[model samples]
Target chain A: MKKKLYDLAHSRAGDKGNTLILSLIPYDEADYPLLCEKVTPDAVKHHLKEIVLGEIIRYEMPNLASLQFVCHQALLGGVTTSLSMDTHGKSLSYAFLQMEIEV
Target chain B: MIRIGSGAGFSGDRLEPAVILAEKGELDYLVLECLAERTIALAQQRKNRDPNSGYDPLLEKRIDLLLPILKEKKIRLITNMGAANPIGAAKKIMEMAKRKGIHIKVAAVTGDDVLEHLDGQQEVLETGKPLSKLSNLLSANAYIGADALLPALESDAEIIIAGRVADPSLFLAPMIYHYGWSVDDLDKIAQGTVVGHLLECAGQLTGGYFADPRKKEVPDLARLGFPFADVGPDGTAVIGKVEGTGGFINLATVKEQLLYEATDPTGYLTPDITADFTTVRLREIGSNQVEVSGGRGRPKPATLKVSLGYHTGYVGEGEISYAGPNAYSRAVLAGEIIQERLKDQFPDLRIDHIGVSSVHRTYFGELREPYEIRLRVAANATDSENAAIIGEEVEALYTNGPAGGGGARKYVREVIGIVSTLIPREKVQTQISIQEC
Candidate 1:
């Protein structure tokens, strides 16, 4: 339910649209080692934690290994916003499971 | 006043229905269609193998048809032709225009290719492969949306060159400028984009790859047509192929094309229109054309991801069907003997499922038990020749090894590839500048 990750998350540099497009961009295999060096365990933890909020925790999905955070923000706000994106490889789906909000 | 127009699909070729319609009818806007995943991969490989190949730059080939018209009609254009090398393409277009004494000013949209620019920053998903795995990753492009075209339009450039923008927006963009359409009017924008999408692929909707290719009775086969978008002030755009062409359209052609690449009609995705594909309706109006109307859409997805593929490695796979109760044991022995023989020919090759569970049992219909076992062998080889050799190696099993070789047996070889890619959400769309001459 975090706004930054939901609103601001993007494909890394050179990959400007979505996750799938980044992977689709023909990249020189020489740069692959650079990718391994960048995915340090700490980076994942920090990035995942940044998207976490009250009653919302970050979790990676099965088979996808994609970072996702579950939340009750949709329920708390008494409003629903649903968005689904498919990139032959990456996908995102979310709904309100629970919530808490004041007027 | 310069009338800048971007079309829906491939209308310039004069072979597709879109082009036929445009040539037959009078229109201000004609868009062509040419972007897909398979295409992206093909174009990228073309550029990867040879940077100067100009495989991705759409405008270069696009100019074959466009240049003549722009000169004839004295019109302005904007297009997403910057597939691989936009700047290179722009240079070519400029050179062509100069020969005709046309002072062509083209705005090449740059800042999109981020592959080489990543400054020590790169990330991929869990598969554990990043930019490095793509050892030969030569080029990268994102499916940039319509907004990218704004800069070029404002410049009043004689032509605007682009790469990977949403197809509809390519046509809709000029409409946005001509009609002064706002971003908030999601409905109007969606309507305009549909016109673009409908005509993007030349023969797709125009009867090229229609359900029944023969029903339309198209004219000339050699000059396959392209698509054109003719939009009015109200956003009611009429789509058609070129005149003097072969293909004809009825309600069926339009309806089928609407459903092309659609599992759910209502969710047609585009940067400009989150089209409501569910309530779409089309009607045949004339002999060779149909009127496309009544498709509503929602807002665009928050994040649009570009797709990419990497060559993981070479894979060799094949299987054989075994019969009888000794299927499991026999399949195992067969695999072992095959691997042993292959190892000698293919040194340092890795063979999986060599012995254990070499066979999977299955039956037809609902109620079925392990009817017979199908044994499979998959090997990974660095060399391409090994793949064909492995097939011959596995098929040889029936004659040379194992006890219950079964009644009917065979081996098939298929190259295996482990493609690993990384896509961060924000970085999916890339913008590259198409320089002008």
Candidate 2:
């Protein structure tokens, strides 16, 4: 079955310089393994191809059932210089949650 | 156990929540983490214009509202609202106390401003270019840690103000002081840092930013209460908010805040300690109460991170709304016209269909044509005059192109760019000056 990542996880995005840090956590601990296998850095890079212009590095926190994606050069230069309406990219988390994952 | 409440998270956070915490919450301290990345830089710019005006504009207003309650409650106040001018802010507070006939002791922690220490030859962490390469540099301040704030805390000052102190440090300094924890205790400092990181954002732990309607509902967001941590001697704490106030604190809220801006889970670096978030534990003990413990840490960094703000250039923006049938297409046409008209002058123009895809640059799921679409055109230029042209051209679209282009608005403003560098810890000096009224 195909299910959206939003069904399994919730996310919040924060920015430092030109990098966007997006934290992904599963609602159920049992779903952690599934997300870990499916939501690879390459997969996320492909998912937000247009939005992120740099590398995406994923850091896992097994204790918290969370995955942190550090997307570099992603804020379109960053909050101070970015011309985007959402300069902080606060809404990018929702965009990441909308990704389709196989269940 | 000592309770500490977060008054304000950012420079422009809601004031009422902090007031509620000061009045009702039984807290030993109230800390407001107001300095953001570019905040002090802008403050420095203001200081350059007028020496006494660089402090947080709301410092006076915030102190005015909370002073009486804080005094009655005997809650020691700590804040980084002293951005670019800790002494000036402290003086203002003392003056306010004298005028109001309130007895209070205010201490200003200075020396975070390391502008003179930088020769501009150092490399900028973001661009990897020599700092000298950047022109019109405005400010440079190091992210001082908990240790720098210890002097003021030890002085027993009722209010402590500082500039460019790391966000978590504002919360951790209180713990170190009250617990009498040694600065060398990396594990204890790390745990305190965790509490600081979580509570520094104020309402975030109590659900100010974490609402999603039916998916994740937060109650009474309008009256969302700020959070406080009850810290024990061991550095473990229970996070809670005032009862009967809006917003709920639970495992979910605590979990979200645990890694708010923590880039690395294992190696979240602050000047006091390199905190390891993976070691932390979160459990819901009761309604709106979560027990947080098990945070560990490694040794502190050898150098402090400095945020440098410089003149980037100018940004010109314009927005116009199109309505009724074929609004999306008409909005797209209006954007195309602006792009074609200003391509040579402003080559890097950005056009956004606000209603459809302004945020993420693309829409998710099925796309439905919005009845009302707002067309936004923005671009950056070397000078304000060139930037103004971007908006001027969009304003001309009212009659020059597109049908029903109503509610057009334009803006042009200077942009400040922030970058980071590192300075040896020994090179930065901190001092404390106390004033009583």
Candidate 3:
């Protein structure tokens, strides 16, 4: 069955300069491996291609059932210089959650 | 065991929660981590304008409100609210204490400001440009760590304030001072760092930012409680909030905050230690208590991160609202008109339909016709005059382009850009001064 990542996980986005640090944690620890296979750096890069304009790196934490994605050149120019209404990229977490994957 | 509670998370966090922590949480120390990346730079700019006023604007108010409770409860306070001007902040606190007839000891930690140490030959981590290339540099302050704060804690000053200390260090320093944990004890420092990271955001660990209506319900969110950690000698702690308070302190909230802004979990760097969060463990032992353990780390870095704030330019923005039938189209047309008018002069101008595609720069989910839409146009200009023109053009739309335009608003703001570089730890000297009232 296909399900939105939002259904399986929750996320939070944080910014550091021009980079975005996003954490994706599945509700069920059993689904950790599933997300590990499906939610690759390439997958997230493609999912948020319109907004994130740089390289994406994913680090897996199996114990916590979480995946940390570091998206570089992502915040337009970060909080200080970005002209976007959402200067902090606080809304990007939901945008990442909008991804659909096989459940 | 020592109980440490977080008072304020950022510069503008709610005040009552810290008061609650000081009063009812039976805390030994209440740490308020207030400074952010650009915060000190902004403070420095304020200091440049007025040498005596660069500390947190709310420092006096927060101290004024919490002083009596803290004094009565015997809970010491450690805060970076002294941002850009710890001495001024300390002096102000002493004056406030004197006026209230409350005897108090306040310590100010200084020397985080290293603006004179830079010769402009260093590299800016973000732009890959030499520091000399960046113009209108406002301030440069190193992110000092737990060690720099040790002398203030050792001085036994009831209120300790500083500028640009790393967020977690504000919480961890007390743990080190109380537990007698060696700075070289990487594992212990890491454990304390984990606790600090979890509790530093104050209400974050207590479900302040986690409520999601039907999805993730947080009870009595109207009066969310802050969190405290009961730290034992072995660097293990149980995180909880005041019972009967508004928010919950369970495993979920702890997990979210553990990685809040921790970019790389494995190598979360602080001046005291390189914390590794992957080894940490969390267990919800009670209704509103979680036991956390197994935090590990490596040696501290040789250099400290220095946040550099510089003048970027100015941001001009204008927003106008439209409603009723064809509001979306009208908003789109209004945006196009502004774009067309400014395209030649402001080539990089941006137009956003607020109800449609503003935040993410694109829209998702089912595309239902919005009953109302807001047209927003913004751009960056080298000068305030050029920036104001963008907003003026949008205001002109009220009479010239859109038919139902209302609630038109415009803004012009100077942009301060923050970047980072590294300075040797030895180059930065920390000093502690104490005042009593």
Candidate 4:
């Protein structure tokens, strides 16, 4: 069955220069491996393809049951330069939650 | 164990929460992490206009309110509220102390401002753009680390003021000073950095920004308590909030903040140490209590990160709301009309339907007929007049375009864009000076 990523996990996004770091943490420790299998860099890259301009890199920490996706060239130019109201890309974290995953 | 409480997370974090901590947390040091991108630039500009007014705007109010409570509680303060002018901020605090007929020692950490030494030689990290390209550069500050702040901890300064130190370093410096930990203690420093990062956001680890209704179920969010750390000699700390205060402190909140703004879990770079949060563990020892351990660290970077601010022209934005049936269509029509009118003048104008496509513009998912929608048009340009034209075009939509378009708002402002680069550590010098009260 298809389930929204938000149903299984919670994430937070923060900006650095022009990159957006989205950290995904599963609610259930048992579901961590499932997230590892389903939420690939390619999946996230394709999921946020509209705004992501550069490459996406994922760093996994099974110890913490969390994954961090570094999305480069994601912000218009980031807080100091971006014209977006959400210049820090604070709202972009939810964009990852929109991903559909089979649980 | 030395208790360190975060009084203010950002420049504008609520003060009431910090008051709660001062009265109850039994903190040895209350660190306030302020100053974010271009904040120093704005502070520098203010100082240029008036010599005495370059620090955090709320510095006086914060000091005035927290002085009696924190002083009686013996909770010394260390803050980056100096923004662009540390010495000036220190002097102002001293003056405030004098007026209140109180005796206090204030120290200012200076030399982070390296605008004069930039020489336009460094390249911006984002665009590989040279610093010489900016004609109207305002301020440039090197992110000095925990070492610069050591003298303040050593001295008898009741309040320490600093400008542009790395945010995490504010919390780490006091930890290093209190624990008598050597600068070379990478592992301990790493652990200290972890605590700093966790508490640096103030309430994030305690649930100020984490509530999502049924998804997260944070209680008493209205009175969300700020975070404090109970650090042991080895730098292991338990992160929690005050008793009977609002907000939840748990593993989920910690995990969320753990990776917040993190580039690499194993190599989260800071001026003091490169911390590894990969092995960090969180345990709920009690209600509103989570012990954090296992954070490791490595040697510091050879160079320091510099935040450079320059004039980036102007930005103009306009928003008009549409409600009732067909709100989305009317909002879309308003957006199209504004774009069509201003496309020639402001070729880079962006139009977004607030409810339909403001953020994450890609996936609108079937349009679901929002009861209300706001059409926003924004553009950036080299001149304020050109930017203002973008908003003017949008405001004209009130009578010329979509029906039921109300609540029009338009604004044009100067843009202070920030660029970052690396500077050799030896090029900058840091110092701490005590204000004669």
Candidate 5:
């Protein structure tokens, strides 16, 4: 079945400087390996290409069924200088959740 | 077990919830973590104008509300209320205690400010630009760690005010003081950091910010209770909130907050220790009780993160609304008209369709033909007067250009942005002074 990543997992967004960190945590423990395989740094970078300008780095934690992505240069100039309405990039998690995955 | 309650997560957090925690939490320490990176720069500017006014705006209200309870309960207080003026805030707290006829001692932790120390030759970590390039440097403070705040614990004061210490360090210093934990105890320090991280956001782990209607409905959010932790001797912690209060705690909320702003799970760096969150474990042992363990640690980072705030020009913004038959088209027309109008004066002006391209910069799926739309134009310029031109040009569209354009609002303000760089630990000094009422 084709499902939105939101249905398979839940995520949160936080930022430091010009970088945004998104944590992709699955709703079920059984989906850990699926995320580990499907949700690569490239996939996330492509998913959020519009706002993300720099490189993307992903780290995994199998025990917690979670993946954390550090998206570089995502915020225009970060919270201090960003002209965007959503300065902190808090809403980017929903954009990440809108990604599709086959289950 | 030592109980520590997170009173205020940020500088502007609710004061009533903190008062509730002080009264009923049975906590030995009430730690309020305020002072975001940019808050100090703003505070420093206020201090420049008036020597004693640069502290937290709600410092007086927070202390006033929790004073009686804190005194009666004998709960020690620790907070970074001293954004740019720890001594000023401490004096204010002392006056409050004295006016209330209570004998309480206040400790002020200082030495985080390094604006005078910078030789204007260092490189900024974010942009790699030399500090000399930035003409007006507003403020620069090192992220002091647990070691700087540990001395405040040794004082016989009931409340400790700090300036620019790391948020986690505020909660970790209490655990270190109580347990007499050795500086070499990486495992314990990491555990303490994890506990601090979890509780540092106050109600975040207690179902306040995690609620999502039917998906994750929380009970009685109207009176959401703040969070508290009971730390064991081994550095493990069990998180909970005040009994009979609102908000719920479970594995989900704990997990969400665990990775809140943390970049590296394996190596969450603080000045006291490099915390490893990968090995950390969480279990909902009971209602609103989650046992947290498995936080390991490595050596602390050699350099401390320095937040430097500088002048970043002025922001001029104008927002106008369009509605009825073809609101989206009218808003788009307004955007184009404004673009053409301001291209000569402000070449870099940005136009955003509020409901469409403003958020993610692209609207997904078929548009429902937005019944109402808002057109926003913004530009950064050398000064406020120049920035106001972007709004003036947009307001000119009220009768000159687009049809049905109304509700135009314009604003121009100064902008201050932050850049970070690391400084060696030895160059900075931290101090603690006590004042009794």
Candidate 6:
């Protein structure tokens, strides 16, 4: 499970050009872990690292321990993009199903 | 030309830009969306920080900006900038308009900020918390139905101003009066609601930061174009964006906008329109235009929407990063230590989640478990001191232990709580204020 999450994170993000940012504004942090399950611990830490890029917007966490994490940035298929590299086949498929878009 | 045109836009601490658009287009009616659900606390916060800051933005600034424009342009506008402060908004608008060389007739419509008025008048579809608890609240602005717009309209004032009315009523009120459509005329009201809904969010439908966000090199989104409706007597209306604008609109844009800020489609409720979204059609026409037609709305509900969030306790946390060889392992140890200790202190339990990435693995991880665990432990103590003490104790762990990698402390304090409100469409609806400004 750990290896799969790790590989998915690398192959999908971390190249460092296509910056991806997520804002935890849903007013609940309970579902945050569930989101990061697909990614490795290292990837989560690296992206959420305060020093990474321009900004990482997280909400509702007033006294936040770490402003950054290897939380999954994906909606369904997995963490989508940012900082690394990965084939978006799973991502595209997931979105296609969720929205039923023709693409 | 006594143009009876109708459209939508924004109204916050300012209504100048909206008046400019109305005057430029020679529009007769303008709808402005000022208040939102999560904004009351924001309003309160602003009030606390600067007694004249929060709601004043929706009033003081509006008067200075619009008074002059109202004098120059003979247009009527309505706004829902009045959350717990319509009289404040109205008084400013009236006084400002007069000073700006405009002899504007205006009336401030109330009956929406019913933190008190919702006595037996309230019914709860959810938990039924009752209007009493809601009273004496920091602020109360009901989402009024279009029925509230009647007063503003009946006053025959060149402009009618109101407090915390729903966003749609800004447009619906004017349409009802011009078309003489009764509030109960669900179908017509639905059309008006549809128009208001489409135009209420302003540049959103015309391609603002939408859900299906399309990044267009619009001429200027900062000075974004608002929506307008050519509402007819039958409740049917033609809606479009500004003329010679950069963005283009069509059925797709309307549908995208319709579903952009999405919720349960069936549960779409605003005080003005009882119509179900299932009944409308978006027919494309000119490049930036779509005609919104066919609406079958329902009757207004008895109760206003409820905005509820209680004073939960306080919480705080600290952060330290792990980077070297055993960074991941060290991070986990740190999380366990905090969790184990917190268990003895606060049983609610502190939560820690771990994720890691590398140059090779991207963010999810590189073919293995996370390389580093970002540990975050949180606890709710009886008081802020209790919460801060726990957070500080965790901060100290990094200095003496292998688990801490980054530093001695990264601590911050704040009251975190879930803010939820199930306001009926009626409670959040914008009361229409058709002021000549």
- Model 4: clashing residue pairs? none
lDDT of 2 by residue, A1-103 (tens): 9999888888889998889999988888789899999999999998999888999989888878888999988988899989999999999999999899888
What's model 2's TM-score?
Answer: 0.99
Give the alpha carbon lDDT tens digit for every residue of A54-89 in model 4.
999999898788899999999987888777768888
Which parts of model 5 have CA positions greater than 4 angstroms off?
Answer: none
Per-residue lDDT of candidate 2, residues B1-437 (tens digit): 99999989999999888999999998999999899988998999999999888999899889999999999999999999999999999999989999999999999999999999999888999888999998988999999998899999999899999999999999999899888999998889999999999998999999988999988899999999999999999889999999999999987788888878887878999989999999898888889999888889899999899999999899999999999999999999999898888888887889999899999988877889898999999999999998999888989999998889999999999999998999999889999999997
Interface RMSD of 1: 18.4
lDDT (tens digit, per residue) of candidate 6 on B54-128: 553545555555556655676776665554455556666665666656677776676654444434335433334
lDDT of 5 by residue, B313-426 (tens): 899999999988989999998888888877787767888999877977776556788778899999899998999988888888898867898999999988888898888888
- Tell me the tens digit of each residue's lDDT in model 1 across A4-87: 221211121111122111110002224323333333334433332322222433222111112222222211111011111111
DockQ of each model against the real complex?
0.02, 0.79, 0.78, 0.79, 0.73, 0.04
**Residue B178 in model 4: lDDT:** 81
All candidates: TM-score: 0.57, 0.99, 0.99, 0.98, 0.98, 0.63
State which candidate, 2 or 5, has the greater TM-score: 2
Best by the lDDT measure = 2
Q: Can you tell me which runs of candidate 4 are displaced by over 4 Å?
A: none
Clashing pairs in 3: none
| TM-score comparison, 1 vs 3, better candidate | 3
How much native contact recovery, as a fraction, does model 4 achieve?
Answer: 0.79
Over the full model, what C-alpha lDDT does candidate 5 score relative to the true structure? 0.88
Residue B341, model 2: lDDT of 86
DockQ category of candidate 1: incorrect
Model 2 docking tier (incorrect/acceptable/medium/high): medium
Tell me the spans in candidate 2 whose CA falls farther than 4 Å from its real position.
none
